[model samples]
Target chain A: DAGVTQSPTHLIKTRGQQVTLRCSPKSGHDTVSWYQQALGQGPQFIFQYYEEEERQRGNFPDRFSGHQFPNYSSELNVNALLLGDSALYLCASSRGRFYEQYFGPGTRLTVT
Target chain B: AQTVTQSQPEMSVQEAETVTLSCTYDTSESDYYLFWYKQPPSRQMILVIRQEAYKQQNATENRFSVNFQKAAKSFSLKISDSQLGDAAMYFCAYRRAEIQGAQKLVFGQGTRLTINP
Candidate 1:
């Protein structure tokens, strides 16, 4: 009955550094997607993972990548972080590619 | 490339009154899905309501309802008997209806709603 859960509620990283955020999808869900929400703006899609392979990706650069484990958990990694990378990263899970997606509380990444 | 727009940056309503947030999207595909998500101060994105493009009936959830105009490509959310708890940032999102692989959601800029008692 547990919903989507993300780790490290808040994080601080310096420029040119790397960071990884984790997410455990909701029970009975398989697909995981990541999104970035900048200040005063809505979330922008980062990418989606299904069957341990990346299925869809947004316009994000190569610096942003993700991984999905067999257990349906996911990790979002951002390399060479910049101040603009500071935002709330959200993790959403759904039963399949065409189902309703439920989101987690999100990890707040602060690039210093 | 689909884009969702929420022209209202902010809106306010008196407690127990009603308020509507506007949203419009541009998509080349005819079959798609639209959603309204509520993000509170806690930053959790909660699904408020959703509308399927093929369906003529607008989607409704409890006190929340949507007016979907397919031709106009407009989707607006109406919150009835608004309460303080309803004060939050509301986002409009769109997704394609492809049955094959996963699709990413395109979100609007978001409308911040403030409920005054």
Candidate 2:
């Protein structure tokens, strides 16, 4: 079966600009979660979406938002991006709230 | 809230040898999950192995296994007969059994593994 897939393997954005990253969850999965992995660091949870609504979020600010479609695809939108926003964006999918998540090849965002 | 820690920033092992990466987490929640993920140069996060907190037996997945110490809050990954393909950043992660928004994963700083041939 096709696993989690993400769009734009890499990206380049300037400060204050906005960017949107897309993800198609693994087949048969229903929930999507976003994470940010900075250089030399493990990923930090950004937020998670289920039933097309956000259910929980991490320490990220309002600038970081996400959406989950009925088909289980997801979009992570970061507004007013800063250089610190430069990191690898990862998308993970799970069948439900208490299942192991499958991850996609991250999109490397380079904020210039 | 939970926190994961990987004290080893980097490690090197010769091919065909065995390497153990250490991890320790702090959590009061008795029911949870522990995981080890491998991120190769391609940047794809691959689930290496998983262990349920309630399970007393240590988890083993082929060449990859975990030493899960529930009371000590320590979970370590062991890779046997390491190959060049095993060179990657290994991450130790923790997830609460409580289902909330897909269950957030708290990851450690990560341990970079280098396999020398």
Candidate 3:
């Protein structure tokens, strides 16, 4: 079975620009969660989507948003990106709320 | 709010030796799940080991095992016969046991493991 897959292994964006990262969840998975891992730090939960609706979110601001399609793929959109937004965006998928999540290779976003 | 902490920023051990990485978490919920994930330079987070808070027995996966002290809220990973491939950033994460909505994982600051041959 194919694990979680993310698009654009790397990205470069200017300040105040918007960037969208895509993720295809593992086969047979239904939920997708997005995380942001800064350089030299652990990943911080951004938000989670289930049934095409956001069910849970972390301490992130409104600039960070996500969408989950019926196919279980996800898109993380960051608006007005700042230099601090430069980090590795990771996408994780699981069967449901209670199962273990499998993470993707992550898209490294470099906000210049 | 649940928080995971990995006090060790970096650790090194000789090849074929055993090393233990420490992790502690703060949570008010009585039941949850703890996990150890290894992120290589490729940036894929691989599940190393996992332990359920309700399970008294520790979880083991081949060469990796966790010392889960539920009462103490401590989850430590012990890696035996470490190999060069084991050199990566290890993270400790926590998830609530709630089954209704999306349960997001809270991760620690990650420990960088170095395996010297």
Highest lDDT scorer:
1
Which digits, one per residue and each the tens of the lDDT, describe model 2 over residues B1-117?
Answer: 789999999999999999999999999998999999999999999999999999999999999988999989999999999999999999999999874445899999999999999
Clashing pairs in 2: none
Once superposed on the true structure, which residue ranges of model 3 sit more than 4 Å away at CA?
Answer: none
Place model 1 in a CAPRI quality band: high
Q: Candidate 2 lDDT, tens digit per residue, A1-112?
A: 9999999999999999999999999999998999999999999999988889898889999999888887889999999999999999999999886788999999999999
**What digit string (tens of lDDT, one per residue) describes model 3 on residues A1-112?**
8999999899999999999999999999998999999999999989988889999898999999989888989999999999999999999999986788999999999989
Give the number of the best model, judged by DockQ: 1
Which residue pairs clash in candidate 1? Answer: none
The TM-score obtained for chain B by all candidates, in the order given, is 0.98, 0.97, 0.98
Q: After superposition, how far is residue B100 of candidate 3 from its true place, in Å?
A: 2.8
Please provide, for model 1 over A10-75, each residue's C-alpha lDDT reduced to its tens digit, 9 standing for 90 to 100: 999999999999999999999999999999999999999999999988889999999999998999
| Collision pairs in model 3 | none
CA deviation > 4 Å runs, candidate 2 = none
